[model samples]
Target: MATKKTSSKEAHHATLDGEDEDATHALELLAGKIGEPPRSSLQAILAGTTDADLVSVGKTILSSRIVTDAARIYRKAWDFYQEASDEQRKRLRGFSKPLLAVAVQQALALEQLDRKLAAKSTSAGVARAAHEKAAEAAQSRAIELRDQAYDALRDAAGRDEGLRAQVDAAFGTATTSETLARGLEQTAKLLRAWLGSDDEALTARLGLANLDDSYAKELATAAKDVRNAAANATNRPADGKVTQGALDRADGINVLIMGQILRAFEGAHGIDPTIPRLVPISTRRLFNRKTKKKAGEIQPPQNGNGPQPTGDGETLSDG
Candidate 1:
């Protein structure tokens, strides 16, 4: 009677405990057969289950399904994230090369501009220095010339009386007109030689060679006038004679020649000469007309309206 004490529910519980190791294998086979669990299956299990063992089992199964679905969703999201990351990297790579090249080119352009600006600044500095040097040289030359002119004028004004007397005595006791004229000519020659010498720094400084055309023309005219005046002075009546005036005019002519020499120096040194207005050669011409032919050399006029020679041996006369 003790051996026959078999409770069915207790026996089932004992059997389930003994087959617990095979539960996972059995679930795998069942999951394959059912394809996948329905979304409401977990809810149905939660509602029906009341016993602690059954509820725990239902919860474990539902939790496993939820974990698997969550894992699947997480895997999909990871894949999408990877794909988006890959696309972003591709876009960044595509833009990076050109942007890097543009940055490099801009840096090079800025460097070149900086170099060019530095070179221009250096060249401008050199040009300015050169111009200043040239200006200083020109100014120095002007000062030297002014000093020389002042000295020459002062010396000429203070002619030595002893030298004049010695010169007069050397000519002879009786100073004839011909002897006096010869002596005067020799003195003029000496003066001309002194003034024309290159040793005179004033001549070089004054730029006499580059006289303006107007000034040169005026000097030439004045020279001609002086020569005419000198001739008139020599041939004038005793009362009409103006010896002092003639000498003064001659002196003026000499001064004009000296002025021309100064102008030439200025021209050589690239300076413009200060002079009177220029005169054209043809301005003072008395006759500038072209010659006309005489009547005897004129040609006779042709008479087209007088008569016409007709064709077919007939002549036509004007009405």
Candidate 2:
């Protein structure tokens, strides 16, 4: 059977659709094995995971600070394994660098995906606020420049109806950005022409010689900010609405390696009991206790369960 071929653009968007049922199904499977932590041990993860759904587990493991702190855990953990001593390597039996590598890649993918989701919610709003602020500033600048020039003209053109008429035409009390911008341009042109006149006494009297350089540049930059920011207010990532299913699936994939990460430290207790701290954000602390090494031979756990999770550490509790 000949299958219809898709164009490159179609293929690209197909990848973006984020409705991969098979990948999401795997997340559903991974979410099931997040064994309940004891009442006094790693109880934090359990609270967030009471529902034990895919997105919930993903959200449980990842707090609000994914872009900066939570996301760095993956690469840092990978580095720990990269420099693992021979004994440390042996400790993490059944766990290979390839597996951690795969986990890190998945972690990176999920991190970027989450960031895109977050930006979609806030970008338009942020740009709108910024545009308003820039426009307000520009309006103020226009008002200031126009008023300063107007007052100069008003005082000089006292009893001179011609120049006073020009000032009236060039300056207005309206405060909108568009109104202010148009009035500012007219006021600047009149001031420049007045300053260039043969009347040195008038130019010096109004002190309008440098209006072209200082006033125009400052007002122009402010006006430009308003224009550019207005564009951003409209053009910001238009498709900010990410699907709930996509978010849930992303969250699932994010924490998919939780059980395997735990299994990696099954015998890694002796190597660094202080670390390989599971997930940097996890409340589950593994191999943090001081274990005994009998006669240089790594002693097994007293209960023989091996490398029990400890209570105290610098682990993240969402605290």
- lDDT score, residue 38, model 2? 34
lDDT of 2 by residue, 212-306 (tens): 44555555555455456555545545463564345544544444443455445644654658447544333232222233321111112456433
What lDDT does each candidate get? 0.29, 0.48
- Candidate 2 is scored at a TM of 0.39
Worst 10 residues of 2 by lDDT: 1-10
lDDT of 2 at 160: 68
TM-score of 1: 0.23
**Among these predicted structures, which one has the highest lDDT?**
2
Evaluate model 2: give its lDDT. Answer: 0.48
Which candidate wins on TM-score? 2
Stretches of candidate 1 above 4 Å error? 1-95, 158-319
